[model samples]
Target: MSREIVLGVDGGTTAVKAVAFDLAGEIITSHHESVPVQYGRHGEAEQDMNLIWEAVADCIREVADALEPDDTVVSIGLTGQGDGAWLIDEDGEPVRPAATWLDGRAGQRVNRWMRDGRAERVLEVTGTTVFGGLFPVLMEELLEADHERASRATTQFNCKDWIRFKLTGERLTDYTEASRSYLDVRDVSGFSTELAAELGQTDLIGLLPQVRAADAPGGVLSSGAAERVGLPAGTPVGMGMIDVAVTGMGLGTVDDGQGWLILGTTGFVGTLLPEVSRRRSQNSMVLATGRGRQVLEFMAPMTGTPNLDWIRNTLGLAEVPWSEIEQRARASRPGANGVVYLPYASPGGERAPFIDTAASASWMGMSLTTTPEDVLRSVYEGVAFSLADCVRTLDMAGDLVVSGGGFRSDLVCEILADVTGQTVVRQDAPEAGARGAAVLALVSARRFPDLEAASQALACPVERFEPDADRGLIYRATKAVYLQAREAIRPVWPVMRGLRYQDSAGDQS
Candidate 1:
């Protein structure tokens, strides 16, 4: 008999990646296709649904082409960037460009909901706060603008769910993705209409599909989808999940108390919990796991990798190796000579410990002695500090497992360890999101009884970066300064936001 294969699709911010894996979770082939992000004035970020779907099809075909003719593909799983709203008509055609998770057009609505105590009810149901980038608020804004269009809408799906629907012809979303959509996480079925009514839209609840995890069987691939992607018809398709949760699974951090930090285009700090931890409230979201366990996800939505690219591109320093920058950063003393930076580059403003939509990046305490290296080091440190804030808010004091492209740089791991004062373990796998989706496919196929067992079988080991006690102490002190600066700057943020809003309104008028 030929070896059974599974295909995992990870639709990310920058690209769509497809990985083919054997029954043992070993990767067979991988492919990626870049997708363009559309940015507009007033922090609006969007993506063309048609283009994204084309990229997905291209990636899947590329991966499938690499597979041996005799190898039988058992199932397909999907995981992608979370929270963005993709509106579709009754025929499942996208009505508009998707409001990417990076977009913050719903900030005003989110703020109003939060202030009106709707956020509390949302939290109680969805296990997440009302954030501007989430699908619920975005959907609400879309509905208010055109009630007739919303009334005709059959479903509102996340990126992954939308793609899966294209393949399987099923309208469904996983628990992890649904958790971020202001749906009831406690309700195993789907969104709670009662909670939806409290947020001023009773009908919106009906737009969501049934909730399942990446490990659940979504449906078989339709003949049309199979022919388009060069896959066998009736191939099993597994339910999809949010990218971060699947990344955790891909890292094999399925055990209770095991934590993973993903520093990709965005950063997320997540850990598996036996049950929900209701103690630490702010900055954390509770999501269901692939293996039926609950996870506490603490996200520091904005980190400076994008900023690093911006600085490099704008300053014509793109050719400078990041290694050289790291070496220079190490030569400098801790704290970047009192220079601090705030990395709030996302349009949805900021989430986590502080839900400040008006927050913008800034450099403080720079002097004549400041070098480009100092600024670069501060950017690295600033991103680390944000991650530390999420850790503190969740009280997640455990072995910190790090994954994502950022971990490829040793400097990032060292800086993260020093900042958090915790040992950072780098996982062996780089494409955790794709791997996680494959793991879910395996589970749905009953290759393993659950995610935990699959994790033990598939997880690979890497070096651990332990925190330097002396450096850790220095970071502890600097963290105090960071906190103070954050508080001091809070008052000015609202005024900045008001001005920006006025300017945007004027431009529209």
Candidate 2:
């Protein structure tokens, strides 16, 4: 018998990563390529559909070729960054550039929704407050901004859905992707007409894609898809979940009350639940993962490791590697010696654990004695603190499966464990999303009955971190001060924004 593998494609915001995994969740081989996005105007982020396809196809073909001569790719699965608005004609051609989840042009609509209580109502239905980066609002924003392009569009797809359509000729999505902002997921099967009408964008009702679970068969990889991606025709494909959803499962985050955290370009802290949460927070996203379980996602749009990269560049420490930075941070003690940093410096502001569009980064208690290393260490603590706040809000006092680049740092893992007062677990697989996607495909292909069995059989944590009581006590006090600092700085954020806004107006005038 030939070795069998599944092709798991992670079509992410900045790049496409195609990984080959066996039923055991081992990474056989992988290929990756970055897909660029264009920022045309304020809040406008677009990617060429052709460019995305090229990157994904190239990665798939390359990874498949890397397999052993006798090996066969039995299935294909996909996952991508969530909430990008991808529009295409009936023929699967792009009507316009695909707007990414990071695009913020719909701020005007987001503001209106927040002001008029539409967002809170959205929280009641989908378990997530509507925002500019979501698909539904982007649909309306697209139509109002570019009627010509919007009129030509025949349907809408999220980033993963678009990639899956290109792979299997099926225009569909899964609950993990669609539940965030598009469809009503109360039943966890199809679109919610009631929620659509509530949003006043029922016109988009027809544009929504049919959603299925990750284990459901959407379609087979067609001959055309095979040729384009250098794979065998008729390869069975599964409707993959959102990146976070699949990543969570791959990390073995299935037990009730187990929280999963992803700290990539953004911060996501979520826990698996037995049922959907009726009382949702203004900043939490309740996701039905199509597995009869609900996940409460309290994501922070601006708190991430990117701030560290930016700081490294700003401080002219480009030559300093992350390993060295980690060493320096460890040499210092917890709390960074009276200096505190808030990791919300992004121009777009923050989105979760409380939606504050005017929020930005703040550095308080910095003295002349503060060194570059001190600031760097403080930044590490700052990002952890931000995620700590989210974990607190989610009330996740159980085990946490952690993933992302920041996980490479033992210090970060320790800090997170300490701050959250929970054990932090890390698996051997770095590509959690790809592992989940592969397992999901295996289930669809009947290699595994469901995600739980797959996770239990193939996944195991390599390292575990427990909170230090001494450090936890320190963080308890420090977190209170940090919370106070965040509140105190809120009023200052809009004032800072007004200066720039008034300057821009004056310039135009």
Candidate 3:
């Protein structure tokens, strides 16, 4: 019998990863390549589209080289970070630097749109609120600043779609990714004309490619792309969605009431819903799951890992292994000696609980006695508290499965369990996004009869970390202090906003 394989590509914010999966949905080999992100002085974060494509090409070739030439790669699936805007010319070459989701330049425009009562219409159409760094807001900003660039643009694509077009010579997007745009997501496919018109770009609807889902085969690889990636010409590629949605599918958390928390560069809390719940209006997004289901995503944009990176860099703690830091953090009592940190290093403000662009990260209640370990532990505790706040707001609290780079630390897992007062299930596979993309590819290729089956085949066993009864009590008590600190800081936000405005005005003058 001939061996059958599938390829999954995940174009992430920091890196592009590719994995080759066997018929049973087991990852045979994986390759990764990091892409550079350019950050400007004015809270601007961007990436070179051409660099992203080069990383993608490198990742694909690496994965293909690891596999046997005769091992038939039946299909390829593409998934990526959502909401970054990529403007391309008629020839599909990017016309501008891709604005990353971390960019906050559009906060003012998004706020104005919200104040004008346009947000409700946007929510009704796109199933998401006006958020900074989203494609529409970024595009609107570009159009306002340089009409020439906006007018000359032929199409607006996300990072993954750009790579897909480069490989297949076909322009298309998946419903899961499309839902993040200001376009309407209520439909299974295509943009919402009503929503597009309200955003002042009815003709912009013509610029978008048709939207599909993971189950649909998007297009075949062109001969040129095939030669570059070491794949057979005409290999089918499945329509892919956002990384978190695919992560949910990869973990087998696709049923209603089942949820997963991904702690990557950003943290996302998501649940798969059987139907689009109107209750999502309160504090969630109802997006397509790319498998004919709806996914409710309650995202918390900042996680603690980045803060740890900051500590390591700023404090010159690179000599110490992260495990040693975790060990020291474990020694500190809950509440980090009454200190707390807000991890908003990316400057796009925050997305969940409150959309405060003026919000900046701080370590409240620090004193002369505060040690580096205390501050570090406080950062971890504070991030867990924010994540807990998001999960608590959900109408239902289900079993929480945790994935991503942060979950590798047992100390962080214990802290999460203690703070959330719930069991934190750790996935067996660390690369949930890539595995999810492969699972989708398998389903699209009919290797699995259904998504659930594909999940069962691909889903790895997880280790559950339950909260300690005694430690849980301490964490609960400390959580009160954390919440109180957060509340106290909320009122001072306006003052901080005033200071920021004055700074901006001075700069302009």
Angstrom error at residue 197, model 3: 1.7
Cα lDDT of model 2 overall? Answer: 0.78
Runs in model 3 lying further than 4 Å from the true structure: 186-190, 278-281, 290-293, 494-509
lDDT of each: 0.78, 0.78, 0.77
Candidate 1 clash pair list: none
How far residue 349's Cα lies from its native spot in candidate 3, in Å, is 0.1
What is candidate 3's CA lDDT for residue 463?
Answer: 95
Encode model 3's per-residue lDDT on 353-386: one tens digit a residue: 6676656777888999998888888878777777
> Which wins on lDDT, candidate 1 or candidate 3?
1
For candidate 2, write residues 1-509 as lDDT tens digits: 57888878888777789998876667889999988868643646688888888899999999988888899888888888888678898788999988877776786688788888888777777777776677777788888888998878878888888888888888888887778665555656567777788888777878777878778886898899899888888999888888877887678776656668888877888776766754335567777877675654556555487777777887788898889878877776788877788888655567868776667787887899887777888888888888888888777766777897777788888889998888988776678888878778888888888778977766855789999999988777777788889898898986775564454545744
lDDT, candidate 3, equals 0.77
- When sorted by lDDT, best at the front, the candidate numbers are 2, 1, 3
RMSD of every prediction: 2.6, 2.3, 2.4
Look at candidate 2 and give me any clashing residue pairs.
Answer: 43-105
lDDT of 1 at 460: 68
